[model samples]
Target: MQQSNAYIIIFSVILTVVLGLLLSGTSEVLKPIQKKAEELDTKKQILGAVVPAEQISRMKAEEINQFYESRIASKVVNIAGEEVEEQDGVQVTAENIDVAKNYKKAPEDRLYPVFIFHEEGNEEAANAYIFPVYGSGLWDNIWGYLALQTDMATIEGITFSHAGETPGLGARITSPEVQQRYKEKSIYSESGELVSVVMQKGEGKDYSGEPHKVDGLSGATITAEGVNKMLKNYLEHYQSYMERKKEGTPKMALN
Candidate 1:
């Protein structure tokens, strides 16, 4: 039997509305779970800056959060490395800080998140300082956490992620091999200048012999350069904080 056009239109409208309602209801019901999962994912990424490559993927969400809370001290800092108590009366914390949002603001106005990982029992001193950095990649945004050694000049580890980079090329930024390249690299010159680590062509040099240069992805030059720029810009913002640490200042060290 052939349906009349009016009847078909009515049926289509009802179906569309029903489907839309169902989707909306599902999203609303799952919103909390989704938010929890996102929080867990961010925790895992932050952990990635400290955890070993083999263990990062194997750790559960609960374990990640446990380690994060116990071993990490998070705080917000301005460009001058001073801890910020509140911005417009809203407390600034590591979990609450939106680094990407702050990036759009002026340098002094930006509030950066810093994660200090220390021994479980000793929160007074940091073993390393992990910083959050983000910038444009080949396709979209790329971001990561960079862990600096207690000296606040050498990189301990890195973990990068992207919104949409080509597979096997720019995407290699997240690979263990690529990330390993950043380990032990120096981000400052001996003269106290902020000369961030560079991504050079080809397999590059042994970082132990050449501290500031690393092997970039073979075919992902633009993405590699993006990483370079992102690191330099973000690290510069923390240089004041780092200098204070080197001088035995109590801003980030005591808390």
Candidate 2:
């Protein structure tokens, strides 16, 4: 016996709806796990700014959370170096402030998230202040965090992540050797100016002994330029926060 066309159509629709519901239910059930994984990844990236990527690789999720919770303190500040109490009627905090979203807002209105890291036992003396930055690269978006030492002028370290930079070239920004070049670079000049790091072309040497110059990718000039611009743009956004720290202001206290 052959089934009628109408009956076949009805069966097909029922099967499709059942499969769709099953898939949706599975996704819903795994939503919490997915969110936890994302949070772990973010913590890893933030910690990567200061800690070596290899070291971060060895850390467990609990270790990351413990380190971030016990050693690192987060604060939300405005362009004027003032700690924000509330924004749009919601309390301002580091976890809630979206740097990418704030990037699109007006310069003065943007909210900045500053993560201050300290040694395990020393909370009073901050080791570094980490800032997150995002920008367009040669092929896609590039982002990373720059950690400035307590002095607020010298860079302690940095980490870069790109969406689709060419392999072995612009992608090398994430390589240990490339990121190490930024370790001791100073963002401030002798005259106390905000001269963010520069990625020079062709062996990218600081022949002039410039404090803020770093070696750029040999053939990936566009991506290198993107890193340079991204650093400057984000650093300038946090200038007020750094300046306040430099002035020994008591506005930001460790939590």
TM-score for each of the candidates: 0.92, 0.88
Clashing pairs for predicted structure model 1, backbone only = none
| Candidate 2 per-residue C-alpha lDDT over 38-123 given as tens digits, one digit per residue, 9 for 90 to 100 | 87887787888898888888888898888888878888888888888798898888866776687778889888888889878676
For residues 86-164, write the lDDT of model 1, one tens digit per residue: 9898777888887778878888899988898989968876788899998889999999999998888889999999999
lDDT of every model, 2 decimals: 0.87, 0.86
Measured by TM-score, how close is model 1 to the native structure? 0.92
What is the lDDT, from 0 to 100, of the residue 105 in candidate 2? 85
Model 2 misplacement above 4 A? 1-12, 204-209, 249-255
How many residue pairs clash in all the candidates, one count each?
Answer: 0, 0
lDDT, candidate 1, residue 217?
79
